[model samples]
Target: MTKTVQSRALSLAPGASRREMLNLTGAAALASAIKLAFPSGAMAQGTGPEVKGTRLGYIALTDSAPLIIAKEKGFYAKHGVPDMEIAKQASWGATRDNMALGAKANGIDGGHILRPKTHLYTTGKVMQNSQPLPMYTLLNLNEDGQAISVSNEYRDLNVQKDSSPLKQAFERKKAAGKELTAAMTFPGGTHDLWIRYWLAAGGIDPDTDIKVIVVPPPQMVANMKVGTMDCFCVGEPWNEQLVNQNIGYSALTTGELWFRHPEKILGMRADWVDANPKATQAILMAVMEAQMWCEKMENRQELSEIVGRRQWFNVPVADLNKRLQGDINYGNGREVKGTNLYMKFWGEGGATSYPWKSLDTWFVTENIRWGKFDPKIDIKALVDKTNRADLWREAAKTLGVPGAPTADSRGVETFFDGTKFDPAAPLDYLKALKIKRVA
Candidate 1:
């Protein structure tokens, strides 16, 4: 028992009844027994993390900052996962392949991954050999800050928040028998969904009117410079770098499409998480702590510099700085100072970190919209198997964090086109979409 409980047990009133004394003593005994059984709060001493560390992979996106910062600032070490490796992944495809291989085969246990990856991996939609790799969605890494950039070829068209102007322009190009392509990191990933949503909202069919292709986040700017793609949606600092290089202008930040939307997540192989629960907790706690650090305005500069180091992103601090601090230069003569569209790592009292099943439902629904998953698939069941919000709550409680989400869902989410996604009725949302591949 703690000192306070012990003191309460000792301080029995002079006229205290025998029953009162017995009750206090009994309560103290139970507390002591419980403490003894589960020492150090959750796990007994020496029964801490089952493993010292695990391999974690990350792309060079700014959203991967939490994982990078966790390793850099010793949060992983502070949480007893000192040997964690934050390896850089070549592309999202590489991430998927390595994830399927697992750490024992020189893959990652998990790090920063796209949120949809959890559903995709669990369902085996994107896995090699069509084999399902059960996974866990631990925590959301960050939100907002991803952008869609249009090539300078369309800069004269002045494509901004509304992409309707591109419809005619793309049609004209296609009429000339020229191939127009839109690039995203993965087929069923966030970038894919964002670009598709933007195009469809403006009356452009993503699959038919324009060719969609997969390009890694880091390669986005380079590919665009060589005229490999007409437009691309990706997380920074590539978009910011594209602006710097004068090759393209950002049509809009993804936040403009859906403010503070769910982006990347902390995902892991389920078998590894199940096998090492304590280690998993340590990793989560560490990343959570790092996320809090990254959210601080004062630390953003250091965050950019640290992640920009040659060993991490190999990017200059300039490409990452402006956006990380909420400064936007659309590169089409539009600039915003200190906007709220900045990437959020941890929102008011850690709300952003809490993994909402509603968001997962939308991802699953969107994937279904694009026919990545079958319409008859059980989204809720798949979400239940993959989402580990219960684990997030446990860590929050252990860390004495207040204001954790009380429910699983974040309620109905409305997008830029005024369409609403009611988590309770996902099919209704899907049916409302006019440009979806789903029948």
Candidate 2:
């Protein structure tokens, strides 16, 4: 079978795409037959995964390293999903549209996505014509490492951690008849919520004091360079790139807003996971191993180089390396070295990678605070349906991951602004927020 498979693969056209090769060889589909022959999460001796591959999407952010590293380091191939395609998405909105299309329609099965997106897509809040695209939160890709950056126009104001200085600066800009804009990657994404929380904590009403807009992660620095936005929140290495280019200064990493806050997640279509359970587990195991690789301090430089290659992020290694290693130059005269605010891929005992249901509850509640979800929406039901922490645990067990959490909830979370969000009482958390759009 190996010889035949290799011969058939070598027989493909010279310039055949990965998708075309998979189709012609029936490698992905044939692996599904293997699934029936074996059992879910149980591979037959010397056999490949349920499917050879599936398309996944990602933006050029550094948090997407796990998926990229998984493909780059042969982790995916090792797990029998050798044909995994990690495609670059143009923007978060594009990611959403492609996700709604699904892999069967030339779209991605899943990839690095915002935590709130699963809830948004599942409920059809951000889908086309309110058509729900059921998705599952398989893994928390990384924690913290996202930052809010200010345009160089406000350099003298010296904003860092606290966003209050921006409140007056923005008010002055607005009173002068100039539009004050704050940009985030997506409407209900981590960036949007982070910037909103930062602004609101500093007494600036995001809805009233500033005009919020959607800017793709890569376009953020360019927009700020052109004076299109006052500040923007997004994941590294864009924030690092903006500082390197002298276009903006970092106010604070999202970790400062809420220490070790969850960011991007590995999300997939529920239908795809249901149809290819073993393949799903294969992909998860591969990504989990990659996350462990990314977490090692010694591999930080090498990790940055691989992701910064032209085929991947096309960014300079200098822009990614420093921040990835916890050395941050805020570009506002406030620099910190060896800080604990770096991006975390796998915390103590795999804490960073585990998909915590409580984190999902916080994201959903924040969306509700901003009026993205109806106040009457059942937050618990939404979290239970969208967050697939059970699958994460199963994959971890198979991988022999040590110290995976046994409980679904991580308990109460406290942010930098002295506000606490108890996952058990999401409504009370919402009630404590003073700048909410909800009644």
Candidate 3:
């Protein structure tokens, strides 16, 4: 029997009693190989490429589920990979730096990293001195999962809420002249972008209007309770944790803003992909398939265990499961409507995994507006650089994933606010914008 078939059989093997593997870390072993005569041609293709070794970097967050899932599931081996080791980084900054200067530099190769960090480094926005190697664009992880949580004190302001809580909340603070502080994971990540976007959407000037700080996800709650921040926009567990502990109340969820916005992407340096194209495609195929498995409600507990494991997120199963299911508990006696904001295990289709060109355009425009990059580069060129739907199509085709992605010549779409985002002609969209850049 071929190795691919052997690997697939192992991955399909039924789980040992659920009691034996509560977290679903590893499925039962594959059946002993039965002597099945294979045709000579059977060994030709469909056997995934050879993978030597990869040093993938990931921060401990619920959204890191995809990487964990890929590892836990035999998706890697099934795709004809040799071995892989996941390196847990201290922080996002450390992760990006490690990729820029680690085994990839002197050892094996650059490991896995966050999508935006890769983009910033490539464009020389975050680090001024170094020229970053571009990373392969793969599947997106979370969409619309960011949450802006506030200390329970906001309830005391008697803020009247209508469509826009942020605006009303800001008005309440202004009427009372109360100072507020909010936090994000990074200056340009979804946490920060969502927090600031929500603030601006409500007519609050994110610059002088309020103080925004950079706090890691694990530290958000502690920082808030310690008076370091009045509120925060961060990924799951932290948001739910605050309410679970009665530390803060959630003001709004980013998922509520647009339902589906790309949050995370599987990232690898361009040099690595160029060096190991087949191996890279194999990893992509495995994760994309794993993502499909994760979208199902039945796989919830299994996924929770894989991502919640001490090695990955180091968080308790109870904490991860709550937000994974979209059930949000806002402080005491309040629960935000449970919604699938995390999109933890999205497949190729639906609201979860498609590479939305318009979405990419919005992210780039915001990056420009925030002064992260000079926006002087041609938006079209940058969009092409940041998004690789063409590469995605090749990987998807290899995996037999249906509905190949097609770039819209018509460009990206316009949002509800009457702001048009054209992926192809980003410069035109930038010129027509009504908002002011940070300068």
Candidate 2, position 335, lDDT: 85
Question: How much lDDT does each candidate structure score?
Answer: 0.91, 0.90, 0.64
**Candidate ranking (lDDT, best to worst):** 1, 2, 3
2 or 3: which has the higher TM-score? 2
Residue 151 displacement (Å), model 2: 1.0
Model 2 TM-score on a 0 to 1 scale: 0.90
**What is the C-alpha lDDT profile of model 2 across 1-439, one tens digit per residue?**
4666555554544454666445544666445433433444343543556689999999999999999999999999998899999999999999999998987899899999998999999999989999999999999999999999999999999898788888888878888999989999999999999999999999999999999999999999999988999999999999999999998899888998999899999999999999888899999999999999999999999999999999989999999999998999999677899999989999877899999999998999999999999999998999999888888999999989888887988889999989999999999988888899997
lDDT by residue for model 1 (372-400), tens: 99999999999999999999988888887
Clashing pairs in 1: none
**Among all candidates shown, the one with the greatest lDDT:** 1
Q: Which regions in candidate 3 have their CA more than 4 angstroms from the true location?
A: 1-50, 105-114, 128-130, 157-180, 336-344, 347-351, 408-435
TM-scores, in order shown? 0.90, 0.90, 0.79
Model 1: lowest-lDDT 10 consecutive positions: 36-45
lDDT of 3 by residue, 177-247 (tens): 77767788877776777776666655666777678777767888888777667668877777877877777
